[model samples]
Target chain A: MPEVLKIKNLHQTFEQGTVNENRVLRGIDLNLEAGDFVTIIGSNGAGKSTLLNSIAGTLPIQEGQIILKGTDITKLPVTKRAKNISRVFQDPKMGTAVRLTVEENLALAMKRGQHRRFRPGVKSQDRKFFKKQLAQLNLNLENRLETEIGLLSGGQRQAITLLMATLQRPDLILLDEHTAALDPQTSITVMQLTEKLISEQHLTAFMVTHNMEDAIRYGNRLIMLHQGRVEIDLAGEDKQNLTVPKLMELFQKHVGSGLEDDTILLA
Target chain B: MAIGVYLTFRILDLADMTAEGSFPLGGAVATMCIIKGINPILATIAAFIGGLIAGLVTGILNTKLRIPSLLAGIITMTGLYSITSRVMQNAANVSLLGKKTVFTIAQNWGLSRNNAVIAMGLIIALLVIMLLVVFFKTEIGLAMRATGDNPQMSAANGIKTQGMKILGYMISNGCIALSGGLLAQNNGFADLNSGVGTLVIGLASIIIAEVLIRNLSIGGRLLTLVVGAIIYRLILALVFQMNVEPSDAKLASALVLVVCLTLPNFHLPRNLKGGKQNARSTKD
Candidate 1:
């Protein structure tokens, strides 16, 4: 039960002191232990994305702390935190370089967190390794090593991106609605690939989703956020038999009021 | 110099206007160094360093100071005018009529003046191309390329995108300045006014190369830059022989670029790969 990630009293405010002053995260805390796959769902503007951004270091933490594997990373920039934290963004285009070849992108991932050097970018040996990894995707991308990633379909790009995130076995992986941009069938494909990869590596992961079924169907735990705070947390046996209606019941029982956003329930 | 333009304009996806300033800066530094009795080889190296500094300044402005890339380049180009003048001893022109240069030194080795210029030019160009080919194949170089294509992905993957950009600017401007230094010697003098219209010529050369070839390997693409420059020069020579106004040379270059850039949109047979049709100017 050793903590892999810990957030304490995290607070985020946008446009402080301006007329449009707003608070996205208000004194929130979270803890994740080894191999804990947590799927988070919340209403629109309930700080789901803001929380993920804060953890990923894209948005600066205004207060409190984020510690990963015993180091205080609250002040580390995105690039610096990237050694341990890998991310698959909502936009598939954001996950990979467009003009780089498939093997070149994979080579970049192979050297993640390592110092860049003057050595050849894609060594012959590495190409074979990349091909082997690509073959596992079952997407026939292994034969297209020299093809530019931009030429690939969005699903293929996302698959490659997911592979890249796990290439070096990151301490944690963050999925910020990574499959939200894909078509329904492609999203299912990517989601399955995600589950397989995370389970295979026993990876500790944090995911944000807007769909309640997705929030319940995937991951080892589920969290519901309301008003920048964790309203309900479920895990193990409590989460195993959960359905959309049961989850809704849990939300109402916990919050003492109906959920603010029915669009999430309908989704 | 066109390769330098390619690095920023094509590879980095930033139209860096600093090439105009750095080119003449290289000329000014090298000319002054040669006049001070420095070896021609050392003078050219000094020019390269000068360009690197100018590129570094622009990179800092764009990355650290958060200036737009285009604006940062223009700022550097405008500011370098006074610096170039100062380097030329407060004069707008510095003559190297009787001074030593790489070309003159090559002539001292029992070659004719034209032969010396040709040999020296080929050697320097080959050396630059080889170095760039090797560097771009390296891990650091690949990362730099990725930084240009997608900064967000680069940062997510643990790359310091800003550092890569600064490095690209240095290399691009370094080549440009080195070319400036050599051109000053070849043209027999360095003039502060030489920077004007330099970017347009470089862009024209690059566009010509694109029109001539499609989907080549990185090394092959770099080689075509040399061929493209030669062809562009030949075209200019033909234009001059046609008795058109020599002062309108810039106009011709602009027209050639415009045609090549838009020709793809006209659905020409240039797409040898049978792949997706790509408009030349819209790669960005």
Candidate 2:
């Protein structure tokens, strides 16, 4: 398996050298290979979002290195690195341009990391291709190609966001609490869609979530972060027989404290 | 000029205060060139380029220096005032009483002055509108629009938002300056203070156009802006004919703009889109 991404000794601190200083990520190391889908679970302020932001180029690297496909990307701006990395944010409205039509947004995603030339944005011939791709989402979005994305429901938008993220097959996909705001049923549907898309594309992904069952069920590997460090990293057979209660027991034994109710949900 | 305002205000989603400065800059540049025996066409092109540079300065101030957009425009506009004055040889008003202009060139082709102005105006407007319509349909134009709509989404999709903004400003100010050059030629003179109330008048035209047409594609919307400007001028003429005093023109423009801008909040049946929410306040 070829390495798709690598993070070495990643550290992030807010308001450094002050009374309000808070270290989010401390001396973390991570790597992902082709087709690896890793789900990360952590309590609030456990540096989950920071780790994801660091990899996605949203947060500036404080004192570490990020290598994507053997290329150093620690200094690249978000837009510069966006060609190979796609993200689905927690806010549904953050993914797609609200005022743009579904097809227009798809067209934008299709040109990700490519220079925009003086060509027609939505070509007459490309409309057929967009329709074909959109129809596979099973959201009846094919007919809504001309409709503004803001008119769609949150689930629909998230689904479209996921579709856009995978439109051109990015090198890595980052999912940061992507469904935290949706209703539980819609969250389940979107999560399932997320899984379907990842598997269909054989993509390398990093997903951060608070739900224990979701963290366990969706991806091939699971990681639990405590106090800014990866406490338990499990994969393949070691993750198959795990349950929520047993995961909590592992957390308690490793961290010497019961799992915070605020962080873990039994349901 | 109004078209320039439309790009910054409606498309770029930034209210640029550089209009007043750039407008006069164009007028002065063209007037100076014409007075120097330069070809009218070349002078107008130079004026347009002058406006582009003005836009570039504001773009740099806003994007690179991290100044808020309005302030960036203000800084550039204030600096352009002096530059424009210098271009006009330190004169507050430069007369072009005997100079040849695009309209005069049309007049030499066997047409009355009135018909010549109308012919040239229509031709230029037609050309500009056609070019803009085609440009907006291009891949780069779509990305520029998306940058205005959602910078975050644009950045996520790998669009360089700052560069888009800079390009938008250049295009917008170029159009504005060209308009100033044409108007200066028509009026036979350029005045330093003529740029006052320019933004309000432009906004008034845009809002009037939107009031008349509720649902339009981007091309349709842009076409209506010209119609809106003509109607706005007619309304002002009517008010002046009613003995409202010519000096009250700015007040009239401001009032008209205020009414048109607020008309959407009334939810007039014909003015509302299918899924229209509150009035769009893309004022800046």
Q: Score the docking of each candidate (DockQ).
A: 0.60, 0.64
**Candidate 2, lDDT over the whole model:** 0.87
Q: Runs in model 2 with CA error above 4 Å?
A: A263-267, B267-284
* Residue A23 shift from truth in candidate 2, angstroms: 0.9
Q: Whole-model Cα lDDT per candidate?
A: 0.89, 0.87
In model 2, the clashing pairs are: B14-B284, B15-B284
Candidate 1: docking tier: medium
lDDT score, residue B199, model 2?
Answer: 78
TM-score per prediction, in order, is: 0.93, 0.94
Instruction: Show pairs that collide, candidate 1.
Output: none
Regions of model 1 farther than 4 Å from truth = A256-260, A264-266, B105-116, B269-284
How displaced is residue B15 in candidate 1, in Å? Answer: 1.4
Q: Every model's Cα RMSD, please? A: 2.6, 2.4
True contacts kept of each: 0.84, 0.84
lDDT by residue for model 2 over A1-267, one digit each (tens)? 999999999889999999999988888998899999999997888889999889888889999999999999999999999999999999888888776778888899989999899999999777898888878878899898888787789899999999999999999999989999899999998999999999999999999998888998988899988778999899998898888888888888999977666445443
